[model samples]
Every structure is written in structure tokens, then in C-alpha cells.
Target: MVHSDEYKAKRLERKKRFMQQAKKNNVFKARRRNNFSKRPNFHNHQQENQQEQQFQKQDSTALRQRGFFQVLPTDDLPQVPQCSHGPCLLFEKKNGPEVEETFFACAIYRNQAEFCDFKLTFNKETGEIEVKEAVEGEEDAEKKKKKKKIFGYNRIPKALTEMSPTDTVLYCKTCINVFPNKHECVCEPVEREALERPTHLLPPVNEQHGESQFFFSTETLDVITKAVEKSKVDGILCIGAPRIFENIRALHPEKNVFLLDYDKRFAKFFPSKQYAQYSMLVDHFFDKIAEPKLMEFFDKSKSILMITDPPFGVFMEPLLKSIEKMKKRFVSTGKEETLFYSMIVLPIYIRKYVLHGNFWMSDYRVTYEGHKLYQHSEKTIVRLFTDLPVECIDLKNVAGYKFCEVCDRYVTERNVHCDRCQACTSVEQGKWNHCEKCDKCVKPRYVHCAQCARCHLYGRCIQKHDE
Candidate 1:
């Protein structure tokens, strides 16, 4: 049978594309093989690699024997100043003690990029950190000039919004752009309803650098939204916490709710006026349209609430600093009388360090839907730390918690009021016992060591709780 001219031409076009792709693949394979062949003395290097592995094992063992650590865990760490990027963490040299023992560097230094230029030398004996100048050579300067990869952003056409609710649009995760159809995308594309519940179909948590995202479970989202409703704030600012923003927008579309998150996927899913591509660590906004939109949110609401569950392992200082910068920006928008409030979710164990400057720990434990550790209600270490009035945390609908009339706050049922402290002292696991020598409530496992002049389990870390 003879085909029509249009049908034959379509088949020919498909054949050309297939041939072009196959040719490109073959060229790539040949170049990869050519580069592999250029390696010097491959067989001789295998023997050297084997010896090097053996040496590394022995070296690691020796380092462990001497109590030298590569990374100083969070519990062992002390409160440090914040760099523009989240927090500064301490790292050990893993070398001889005669040399530098420890130093504080940017948390993002190794995890993502070397954008932060802050470094400090720690005096273990004196417990002080001094700024250390970074030495930049010519090679280092050249690397600095080479910027990281940046992708262009494109909005799904507003015309799609005028279509039926079931109408869908195409989005490409690889190109970080949206298109009307796969033929125009030039990248692998997924189709979803642009106006209706597109957030439900967002790509899984970003495994890439510069962000760590774990969304809130449905129950957790309910509790947060309820809290915002009771506050009756004019606006809600969700930093690195998109679920709250989405929930508030869905349930109360009239209320002014905005999201600032590092995940650019949100930029594609939500309208520019409602969401912004934000980085909490560097306090930067990648999208240009976000600045005016943020100011617009500020002006509409005299009272604004900021809810943040930043990336795991972030420090308290930088998080607070970034919020202040945002708060200042909001105040500059001519709403100074509108008090700014925030609820920062963090590990329960770190309450000791973060309970300053109007921040109070709430008994409402926050859990993630798919997180490995924080998914459980009982053992989850995550808790809400808020500057709002402690009396405002109503956990009547939640389980395993009781209200403390004396302190006017909610706490775990395991927490008992300490007559001496005159407050509910229990934080993480069990009821606390007041130590006569320490003159304060301490964990039941704590044993006061007079020589050390502190309450701690000897030969163990004090910061590590029942995990």
C-alpha cells in the first residue's frame, strides 16, 4: 500500500533523529575509551592502589586509637558565630596534637560549595575562636571565577490557568523549565494539572547539593496550620518549609501566605506571587520577581508569622540572623507595629542552647512523613521552638501530652513539674531528677562527677540522648 506524502515525511523525520542520536552516542563512547587509554601505567598503578588502601586502613586505626576525629559531631560542638551560610561547624585535623587541633569552617564548605570565606582557629585550652585569613593562590582564584551551573526558569503559560481544571502542562526537571508540550521541551517532561494540586505531583525531595528537604506528614501539617489560624496573623512566611505555605494557601486562600524555599521545583509548581526560590544559608533569593512579591506580602499583613524547618544539621545562629534580615526587610515595608513572630523547629536535645531571646520550647513534637528517624510520634527528636507565647501552643488534639497549669505550656506526659525549678523540665525522654550538687534538673542518667564539676556519664558524650 502507498502511504500519503505527510505520513512518509513523518517517518523520515523520526529516522533522522534516531540516527543522529546513535551517532552522538558512538562518538561519546569512543572519546571515553580514548581518554581511558591515556592513563599512565594502569597495571603498575593497580599494585600501588592496593598498597595505598592498606596504608589508609592502618592510618585510620592509629588515628582512632589516639582519639583523633575527622568531624566533631554536633553534641561535642560549642555555640559558634554564624557565617552568611547557615552555621559554622568544627572539624579536627586528624594529625598530631602538636599541630592545630580543631578549626571551625563553613558547614556548606564541603557539603555544597566553597562560597563561604569564613574560617576560624580554635584554642581548645582557652576555648576561643580567632579568625584565620584564607590564602588564595592563582589556581584558587581561577577556580573561584568559574561559577556553578545555573538553569533558566520559565513559567507555565497563564493561558493554561484559564483552561479547564483537568487541563495539564508539561514540566522538565532536567532543564528546570516548563513547556506547553513534550515536543517543545527538548528534555524529559512530565505532565500534570498546572492549576489544580500540581504540588502533589512535585518531584521527590532534592537530593542535590545546597538543600536538604524533608516534608511534614499530614498530621504535622494540620497542627501547624491550626497554630497559624489561632494567631490570626495577617501574613505567614514559610522559610524552607513549603508544606505549611501550601496548606495555608489551600485552606485559607484569602490569607496572605508566602513560601521561601531552596527547592526550585516550587518555582515551577507555584505562582511567582506566592512562592520564591530562597536560600536560608546565604540569605539570598535567586528569582528577581520575589523581592517585590515579598514586599507586597508584608504590606498586606500588619502581623506576620515565620515558620521554618531548615535543612538538617543547620546551626541556630545563622537561622536567627537570616530571619532578622527578613524581619528588618519587612519592617522597612512600613509595618513596624505589626509584631513579627516565628516558630523554628529543631531537635529537642538542643533546647538548652536555643532557649534564649524570647524563644520557648513547645511540647508539640514535629514529625516528617517519610523521614527515617522523625517519623515516629514517641521517639521523634524534632520539636517546635517558638517566640510566640508558650500558652498559645494548644495540644488538646494531640496525644501523650498534658498541659502544665503552673508554667502555662504543653509538655510530654513523661515530663513532670519540678517543684524546685517551678516548671516542666522534661525535654526529650523521661522525667528529670534534681541534682543537689548541680542545683538544677538533670537527666535521670546523669551522674555528677565532682572532679569534672558537671553532670555527665563518664567515658560517654553528654549531648547524645536516647536515640
Candidate 2:
């Protein structure tokens, strides 16, 4: 008994130390930063989430950690079994990031989304691929094939009328699938009776993986919904903001809200007609049928409003190219480029990317649901960048903002219009002080340096900043 007590004490101490180290290394992140972000992330290289460099026949082609789902220019692997993220890559047991059998995986594969089930066993010795038929019950197969169109926010599957009490109504969080009440699962399954509705059982994909999936707060969703409500367009394209898409659909049943997101779990909520698994950065659609639907929407609607909340640090160059491609595709359908405007939600720090695109940042701070930083208070970094007229932003509904006649823009009440600059100039963080030397308004933290002839942090000059 004394030995057992001693072992318990030592184990508890070890656990305490491990938790401290985890906190220090940022093991639990609110938002996953990209490889190029100023923020650094410590990955568990030996654990399940580790991504090792691929040593394959085609050395040039590799899976990008940044989650840019671009189709690689390689022919080493056969394209017969292509997944949503394009051609699958061969993963050998020897060079795998985690302990695994030799297999092929979707290029942008991640456990969080569980977006694709496109794993094929590849024998390194035999140089052959093994295909396994998915053996699902006929009832489950029928339930999957019966894609019910969700007309309203209360997305009750119409086919549920046939569901009996003995049906597989229990949801297993570990497997992210519904199972029979008595069926074996990794953990205790959530009872159907415990939920307010069956749709409530659809677990939120809150984990950070290849792409960050921070949902918008109810307040943020309300603000965006108001904006969509005032729009003249009947078609709403929610590129990455699923919350916004659902809200728009719920409130305005007259209008159609289409969701184009990378999260495959969202498929359970929405029908294929309304939702498409897509990577906006590379402008690739996971489903072949998705394009025609979007094109049809574009052709039918006289005008469409695009509101995107893309992952942070997404390659702006390719994103712009994708937008341009959308416009081109619309034009090719023998229809004039409809009145398509965009409202992109991004960090205020990366305003340089949208500088020349006729995109202007509204004074309204875009808050999020589960994001650690952009939740509330002074740390609100996300803003609604839009191509719509400044007057279109209804700051009157929200607080802390007013319309500036001189600047012809909506700005925070803290922002003082700079007559010399002829612009509001103040960003989302707070008010900015105008520097006569730089002839522009800079952040409150920046100091005008005479030597560098620019506004920057104290003791940090451009010459030595890189060092």
C-alpha cells in the first residue's frame, strides 16, 4: 500500500510538470498559426499530428503544411483514386510522421475535418495499391444518399420520420458518427434524448489542424446578417464563414445562402446543392458537381454578395487569382459579370494585401466565437474588409462608430479624421497619431524616427530589424 501511494505521488508530480511544459510550449493554441506567421508553433513531431518531409519518387511534389490545396505537378502516382484535395500521396511506413501502415492519403489530410476517407493501402515491396470496398449497412448507405435540402436554420432531416427509437440515433464523438445504442464505440456515445434536437449532436470541429476553424460569435453573426439583409442581391456566397451562411439562410428564406468551405464535417448539416467542399486559396472543388451548382447560382442571380472569412496568413496572391478565376468563369457562362461584391474578414495587421484591390476596412471590429484573441475587448484584430460602398456598412445598428462625411467612410468614434492625409487612417487596434515627418498616420505605439525617415518601434531600425 505504501509503494502504491509512492507511485501515485510520483505520477501526479510527473503530470504536473508535463502540463507546465505544455503551457510553456503552446501545446493548446486557440488559433493555429501558419509556418510563415511571425508567431511560432512547437509541433509534437513524434506524436500523431507530426508532419514529416515526404521522401518519394517525385521529390518536388510534397504536402504543404500551410493547407494551400494546390494540385502538385507530379505524375509519379496514378490519378485514378483522386480525393477532394486532388491526387493522393504515397506514405511509406518508414518515413511516416506517425506510426502507420504504408498508404496513400489526401494531400491536405487532417483528422479534425475527417473530410475524406480516401486512404488506399500501398505495398512498397509489391509496388501495388490495395483497394478495399467500404462495407456499410444498406440503411446507413441510404441515409447518406438521401441528401435532404435544408431550407431553414432549424435543419431537421426530413427523412428522420422513419427513424425508430431502436435506430442508431446515438452519436459517438470519438468516431464522429452516429451508431446504434448498443453498438461498441471508443467512448460512451451521446444519448439522443440528451440533445434538444438531433442536429445539436453534430459536434463542432473546434480543434486546430491544417486550417483554423474559429466560428463567429453570435454578435458577429448578427452584424454580418444585418449587412446581408440590406444587400440588394438575392444570392449570398459564404466562402469560409459557415456560421454566417446558416444565419443568412435562417433569417432570409427568400435569399439563398451557399456555403463554400474546406470543412467536410459541414456536409452533415447542409445538402450538396447548398454546400461545397472547397479550398479557396487554390480555387479547387472537392466534388465535381459543385462547380456547375455555383455557376448556375451565378447565372440565375442578377447580383451576388461574397463574404469570406478565410484562414489567416492565406497566400493573398493565389486568393486574388482564385477570385479572378471566379469572375472569368462567370463571364464564360455567357452572362455579364453580375453585380458581385466581396466582404472579406481578415486581421487588420495584414491590410497591405488588400491595399490596391479597392477594398476598404470598416470601423466595425469583427469578433469571433471560440477564437482566443479576437473574442472581445482591446484584442479584437479581425475587421470586415469590403468592396461595397462605405455608406453600405450600417454602423448605426452597432456601437462605437460614426460616418465621416469628409473621409466618405465609416470609422470608429476614436478615429479623428486627418485633414492632411484626407483619410480616417486609424486602424482597428485604436486611434493613430499623425506623423508630419512620415506624412501619414501611424499606430499609437509607433514613434517617428528621423534617421530611418519612417515610423517604427523604439530602438528598432529597418537596417537592424531583420537581425
Candidate 3:
């Protein structure tokens, strides 16, 4: 078959365009690779890297001043201060309420409208946060920043500013450049980390992972433990603590200890009876063990304090319950011990469970995910705790799909989908991965000739619940 003249000409033009584009792409890739390879020999690269480190240090210091931390002169940011007990970036408000919300990257304060008892303040004069005057122009300036038309400002959190892409007019310690955005910066994580949080006193957590000193950074761990211990909480309960919790226990053994997890293997490390004393609720982090179910173990009469690394997104349960009990008793009374305490790292599957109500605003140590993957803010923490109730729901709605402990949700022969497959089953499989062949959940090591795009487990990854 012969093609028409117009078709042939058009086809040739298209081919020429494709070749040019491909050639351009290849050239760009080559240049990028060459530049990366020569970076070590480039003295400017080292100098830029050092400058970035200095900028990050400045930004990190600024971060601690959430409501507004003081920016010591470029020459005078004190030696990361003596954070031997708490977080280096953390600071005491010095004058406000005894317990001020903790900000990972910023200082937080409350205006009089939010709290009638006393307005929280940040004193630049005394470095003491006190109840004070409404600074004129400050609110307007901040509102102006908020009102600016920026595509990602709504999605991007204020906490992310210090860590986000380096901005030309704003603080971005990563690239050491005053560039408007981080999109093109070629800064390394090490340089970023250095700028975000000075490590003059302690090395990176990874290098010290196995070593006892690194494993237990006395400064950080002690600060974390003391922060919890000093709190007004009555008895403390810790679950699925990973190895870090052990450090907490070693530091403050007097705090009540309860090890709750599905990991029966750890039970072997402790003698049977001792382990038994520490109640093992035998629930996965993702399981929505009903609040009523938890009630059986809770003594509502006592000032009970609870803690757990709840599956992601479900951290709001305990706070909601505490608010519920608050209607009947004083919040400061510790009446909701069954559902209150410090940090809880939830997994992705169960993260959205907390969005149904005002429970998202419970005041506590920190509602945080480990690894600092995103913006860490004390303002977010405080907002979560102090917000008033607008609506309430039975906590189980957020719990997620349900399946009995002894059900086979995965067994199928004729292209079957199990309706009973509720919670994740791969915990039993010991390995979790996508199966390109089955187009379904399967062991990570599955080998097959054909591949499918869908996951074999929950089918396709369900959209992360709208948080």
C-alpha cells in the first residue's frame, strides 16, 4: 500500500520532531550526569554546600520561634543551647502556662480571642512568653502572607516553610540560595539536615544506629522522657514503642509501663509472668479495637493515662474520648486515662480514622509521625488539642473494615474477591508487596510471567482517606 503525499510529509515532519526532542533529552541528561560527577572536584560546590549549611542553621533556629522565635544576629545563635534534656530546637515559653504546646519548627501562641483565661504571648524582650498585648501590624502582615495567591500554600503547611524548597525572600537553609523555590536546587539531604537542625553535638541518627550512644542519644531521649514524665498525666501506657520506647523505660522506669502489640515474639524476651503483668491487648496497629472494647480494660474512675503508636490516621480516638469524658469531669483531672497521653505514630492504612470530628484538636505531647517526613509544627499540635466540639461520631466509623482473627480473606479460586477481606491480612503473610501478575495482593517474592497493575491485597491501593 502506498501512502498519500500529505500523509508522507506529515509523518516525516513528526519523525523529525521526535528525533530532535530525543536528542535534546539525551544532551540534557549527559550534562546533568557530567555536572554531578565533577561536583567533588568543584571547589565552588563545597563552598556552596557550606553556605547552605549556614542558612539551614539560621532557618532551624527561626523554626523554633513558631509564634516567633528570636533570630539571634548571624554571629550570635547560641551553641544549639544546652538541649541535653529536651530537643535542641525545643524551648520553654518561660512565662505562659506551665505546659505550652511543643513546636518542632515553630513557636505557638494564643491570642485573647482563643482563650479567655489568659492570652499566650511571645516576649522578644525577656525571651519569656507571657500573656500580653496584641501586637499591631503583626496580624495584618501574617494575614497578608496567608492571603497571597500561591498554588500550594493551602496544601503546603506553614511548618514546611523551613524545610520546604528554599525560597529567595523566605528561609530555605537547604540550598543556601535566596531562590524563590526548591524545584531546581541540588542540595543533598546531609546539607539540608545540617541547616534544619545543627548536629555539632550529635551525629546523624543513622550513623549512630547500632552504637548504644547513638541508639540512646542521652540528650534527645532524656528530653522526650522528661517531657512525658513532667506532664500532669497519672499512669502512663506505652504500646508498640519499637526500640525507642525501651530507652524511655530505661530513663524513667517509674512511669507506668504497658507493652501492647501483636508481636508475641517480644513476649519471649520478658518472662511469661512479667509480660502478663504488662497487658498484651493482641491488636494490630491498624485494628479499630472499639472504644467500648478498650473500656473493659480501662478504669474510668482513675486518672488514667494511655499511649500507643496507633495505626496511622487513628490518633484522634483517645482525644475524642477524653473530650467526651471532659463534659463529665475536669480535663486536667486525667479522667480519660484510657485514651490520653504522648505521641502516637499511626500507619497509613488507619490514618484517616480521626477526621470525623473535633477529636483532631486534642492537647497532648505530640501527634506526630516518626522520620520527620513532613512539616512538624507545634501549632498543628495545639490546634488539634484545643479546638471545641462541633460534631461527634461513634469512633468505630473510622476504625476501618472488620474481619475476625480466624478468617481466610484471601482464599479464592475462580477470580473471586472476598467481601470479608476488611483489615490488612499481610501482617499474617509477614511480607507485603504488589503482585504485578495476579493484579492482587501476594507475597513480595511472587514470580510470574505476566504482571498486573492492581494490588492483590485491597485490590488497588484505596485512596488515602480524606484527612
Candidate 4:
């Protein structure tokens, strides 16, 4: 008994010494710094105040020198309510040393009224102003008010429904033809050789390897474009959607766009230098194949943007892990202020990995380009989780979601919009669980049972039916 106790004591001592040594290592210190550095900085108040003062001074000087006080003589400036100093301004005036003849532009008149009819031109040599009225046709006015129609399953013409199956092809939400059809759609044929292995390695679809294709609608791409443009993102990393990559490249040709996917076929679409083949299923996938290339891209610039539509079932873990790896590689110590934006499209129910409070959820449902009516009862209520501020997006045009006045963005908890149910379920309860099959949210611990045709609590199904 004495000998056994001594052995155990020695073992414990050795383990303790090993841990002590590990703690002393530089790698361990780096890991600790990475984890704890994300905490809110409480000591920067003085520095922040100085920066704000300097910024205000610079902004006031710039606004004043831009000839904001010089009004066109021919045009009439609309009268508006005046403040104690002058006219009510759209932008707040600085309280520092005031410039001569500088007055604030009327907030309502400058913004609310139509400005397209008036054009202002300056002559450099003569220092003269030219004000011309723009002559626009009724057709031009109609076009300006019309919202660009987004192409989706909902937008398919009713006449297409009457067409014979022989003459029309059934396209999935991703715009892939899974059913029998004779009509030739615009979808490109799958490059069998380009797939790293097969479709089985991709996601939820465990079937035989074939054409596993999905494309983004034009309207969806437009929203993405606006977000990227507003954010001023210079480097983009796209995961699954090739159509997104193509559109992003066209929109911002100067920006560095990299594509990482299991589809080797993307090599043909983009130069070999721009594409990298990666399987998300493999552990440490980014470190093994993506790290070097990512470092090279990230080193070129600090502003990096990532957009991904991860596969169903196991989306959050691998996707978040990949994001952490990217952050570690790109964001070094003292570079926490580096602008990083991520736009993730995943089902609303998967909220386990969302414990980190850095992301904001969009209230709208994402309708994929080729989503078919038979496969999905309604458009899937996928959330657009992002770190960017809500002000970067125009909430009205984004669809199905609204900006919260309190949070300033569509948050995951307490702000969910159900399109099919036509309700905003934002009560005092925790986040709602959306069931795609039922086309609405079910109470916590409850699931939609196909047999009973309604959501029921787990392990308490009263209606006995075959699975």
C-alpha cells in the first residue's frame, strides 16, 4: 500500500511540472492572449475622447470649405424651422471656433424634397455658378420607382406551370434539376472531374455523387453587393456559392477575391492562382491547406470579408471553427481593431454556436435562386448573421426583416420574423425555434411530427404512427 501511494504521488508531481512548463512557453502565452484579448477595453476612454475631438475638428473644417454656405442665386432654398444659432441642420455643427458666413443646410429641405430636378455646376475660371433644370420623361420617373424584381421560385410565371413536363424542367431552389426533365435550362452541366471526391463529401445529401449545384438569385447578389460596397471590404473569401464569386468579381474587379470549396471545377471558372480546394469535413482543414494562401491574402490588406452558406445539419461548428482559424491567422496582437466582416446564411434553429454575442441576425427569410415549391413548403427562414453595423444595410429593401430601434440591428434573440405565419414573435421568451417542415416556429423542446401533422413535445407524442 505504501509503494502504490508513492507511485501515485510521483505521477501527480510529474503532471504538475509538465503543465507548469507548458504555461511558461511562448505558444501558450500567445494562445492565452488570443482568448482574453477579445474582452472589452475599459482603459481607452481618455484616448477615445482625444480621437473624437480631433475628428470633429477635421470634419467641421472639411464641411465648411466644401462651399456648403454658397447657395445658387437662381434656385430658392426651402424655408425650415431655425435653431437658436441658425437653420435646423441635417448634421450637427461643432461647438468650436466658428467660420464666417457658414450656416447649416436645412435638414428636411435638403433630404425630403426631390433634388434630381436641380443640377449645380461650377466654373473654375470665371467663378460663376450654373443651375440647370433636368428634363425627365414620365417613363424615366416610372422606372425610378419600380423595385428590381428578384428572380426566384416565387417569380416563375404562372404560364410556366401550365407547360407540359416534356417542355419544362423542374429546378430546385439552388436551380439544380433533380427530377426528370427534357427541357434544357440555363444551368451549366456539373464538371464530374472538378469535384474533389464526390457530392457525398459535401453535406446533408448522403446520396450518390452527381450534379450538386446551387446558385444565388440576381437580387440576392445585389443585396450582397450593396453590403460589401458599403462596408468597403477589400478582401473577400467565398465558401460554397460560385455564382456569388463571379458576381463579386464583376462588381469589384480590383478587390482580391478568393474561392475555397470542394468543387475543383471552380479552377476552370477562375484562374488556378485564385482557387483552393478544401473539404470542410476534415479537421484542421484551414491549417492544412488554406493557411498559407490565407496569410498571403490577409497580409496584403487588413479589411477582410467572408461570405458562406454552410451545408445543413453540421453547419455551425465547422463554420465557426473556420472563422476562428481565419481570425487567428489574420488578426495579430494589437490588431484587434482590424475590420472583419462575416455574412453567414444558416437555419435559425442552429443557435448553439451563437453563444458569442458578436453577430446580428437578419429578420428576413433567404429565398435561394432555385428553391422549388415541392421541396420547401415556403422559403427557408435563414438568418444573415453579421458583425457589421445595421446602418450599412437598407432594412426596407433587404426583405422579410426589420431593424430593431433598440438593438440597432436584427438580433438573434427576441427578434424573429415568420413570413408564412405573418407575425413578429418577439416576446420575453428566449429565441424562437423555426421548423422548416412546419413553416413556422415550434415551442422549445417540441418538434414537428409528420404523422400528427403538428409540433409536439419530444418523447411525448400522443398520436402513435409509423416512422
Candidate with maximal TM-score? 1
TM-score quality measure for candidate 1? 0.65
Q: What TM-scores do the predictions have?
A: 0.65, 0.63, 0.26, 0.44
Ranking according to TM-score, highest score first: 1, 2, 4, 3
Report the Cα lDDT for candidate 4. Answer: 0.52
lDDT tens per residue, model 4, 176-258? 32223433444433332222222222333322221235455565667777778888878888776566776777667899887
Task: Give me the overall lDDT of model 1.
Answer: 0.69
| Tens digits of per-residue lDDT for model 2, 1-467 | 45788899999999999999876555323123233344433454453243322222323223221222222222354453555465554444432234346666654452223665667776656767786765758457546545453333213243233457666565556544454445576645455444322224455556554466777877787777777777777889888887788777766878866888877766655667788888786577867778998887777766778888877755466566677787676677675664777888988788788867677888788887667888883578788888876667777766777888998766788888888888887774467888888888988999988777788876456333332
Model 1 lDDT tens row, 222-308: 888888888888799999887788778778987898888766766655677778877675466665667888898888888999999
lDDT of each: 0.69, 0.66, 0.34, 0.52
Residue 426, candidate 4: Cα error in Å is 3.7
Positional deviation of residue 93's Cα in model 4 after best superposition, in angstroms: 64
Looking at candidate 2, what is the lDDT of residue 183?
A: 50
Candidate 3: residue 415 lDDT (0-100): 23
- Can you write out model 3's per-residue Cα lDDT over 172-249, one digit (the tens) per residue? 334233233434655333332222222221232332111111122333334345545545444444444433445544
Arrange candidates, best lDDT first: 1, 2, 4, 3
Query: Which candidate ranks first by lDDT, i.e. highest?
Result: 1
Cα misplacement distance, residue 15 of candidate 1 (Å): 83
* Per-prediction tally of clashes: 0, 1, 29, 4
